[model samples]
Target: MAIYSSAVFPPSQLWDYAVKLYNNPEVSAACLRLQDRRGLDVNMLLFSVWVAASGRGRLTDAEMIAGIEAGARWQADVVAPLRHVRRYLKGDIAPADNRLAAELGRGISDSELFAEHMELQFLNEILTRPATGSFGAAERGEAAADNLAAYLGHVTRDISRDDLSDLLQIWQQAFPGADPRLTGLFGPSLQ
Candidate 1:
């Protein structure tokens, strides 16, 4: 299951953004919270952020549906099972050979990452690049908020204040230099 082939899933800006954002401990924690608690697709969440942060603009309903549908299929078929198995491997239920279980867990983790990369590639395919015009931080920030809100709306209407804080963390981390006021724009739907 471990195939170190870049050709399988070529590098993409979405993947790069996801890596950089996820590297931030706060952002990563927020993302996992959204994933574990809300059952939101983290890849789709990242895709929403990338779409706005990269100046591609807000996702249209069609594009949003495309991303959601694609992510759901891949996540259900590949990523989720990999994650389940990886968690199982790390659990006390695994064999007494902790070292071997740890090694196998690493391989599963790599495979999970590869699956995520592929998911990002599929998401990247849904993007429609806008015209060659400047999109300032303000505009990007607003779009990021909208994108995140829209994605969250589709997943669950039960967004809490804590969820908003996590969402804000993700948005701010996505555009750290953006307006401090941008955080207020994230969840008008929830408000």
Candidate 2:
């Protein structure tokens, strides 16, 4: 594993948004499920919400593609590999008395986080220019839903019912104060 220097990259709004959201247990589990089962990019998922929260109403298909492409190579080459190793270490491969494997797993986990931070930074560069349509707080929740659906639509047309549930969990966590009317909007609104 390699060490990553945080001094090289300052945190951005997207990073801050992601950290707070992912810290929620439900959100983190849902995100991991989407990543592991649905082949979704968690950073891209978080980016969509961040953009919406930032008041950018909805992302165009082209914009969604750009976000996906921005960190594709890095995610494939760096982040995924590090995650694979870190997960691989969570087994009985090591002798009972050995702490080396556990310590190595911790290092790999940190490196994975650093790689994700780098990927978020890359995605943030594309958002430097202001988007045309901006929404206020009331609309931001709907905007967040639209942005997530846009990003998910880019991945697959057939979003399963369970996927919507996970997405709803994520959306609710992202916008805890979203109107009750806006709550449970994923099924029909997202489609």
Candidate 3:
């Protein structure tokens, strides 16, 4: 425990963003549903959001959390989800509907569902790509080439970008060949 604690770093905007990102009705619902059906924790749930968002491009934890909570891919997840969202976006995919979609939108198959996931896929792919800088601030560029690339390595390298998110990575890395989406919500505007 002490060794791990020594490794712990101060929380950044990224961590705060990650918290807010996951702390929402949709993500909460997704976590809840996953928990209800199979029991998940805050950390595991957060990891899921990370994968979904990272697929898009470089995302701060916040952007990823927001996208997941919204049930859209993380803005941090990348541009792919954004593109997906643009496709599924319509006149009424507002916040409440988005939330409802997240709640009621789980595991149902339909053309609408397929299209929505695809949009999110774009979001996921873009998120996993890589953010050039930090939150547009010059002070916090990633440390160096090796470190930066290692970080992006986690962001990329999934068959589906969502798999790049933390939990799936662990699941696949540890267990190999597991279902990333044993559960989650639907709709372009998930949160």
Best by lDDT: 1
Order candidates by lDDT, high to low.
Answer: 1, 2, 3
- After the best TM-score superposition of candidate 2, give how far the Cα of residue 39 lies from its true spot, in angstroms: 0.8
For all predicted structures, in order, the TM-scores are: 0.89, 0.87, 0.25
Kindly report which residue stretches of model 2 are placed more than 4 angstroms away from their true locations once superposed. Answer: 1-5, 94-97, 131-134, 180-191
Residue 129 local lDDT, model 3:
47
Over 1-191, each residue of candidate 1 has an lDDT whose tens digit, in order, gives: 56566575666878888889989999999999989988889888888988878878789988998899889999999999999999999878634688888888999999898888888998999876753447887888888888887887777878787888788888888888776464445535344
Report the Cα lDDT for residue 63, model 3: 46
lDDT of each: 0.83, 0.81, 0.36
**Clashes found in each candidate (C-alpha, N, C closer than 3 A):** 0, 0, 41
Best by TM-score: 1
lDDT of 2 by residue, 3-119 (tens): 666778875778888999999999999999988878899999999888888877667777788898876778889999999999888887756533788888889998999999988
Predicted candidate 3 versus true structure: per-residue lDDT over 44-76, tens digit per residue: 334333433333223455544444444433222
Q: How does model 1 score by TM-score? A: 0.89
lDDT of 2: 0.81
Instruction: Please tell me which model should have the higher TM-score, number 1 or number 3.
Output: 1
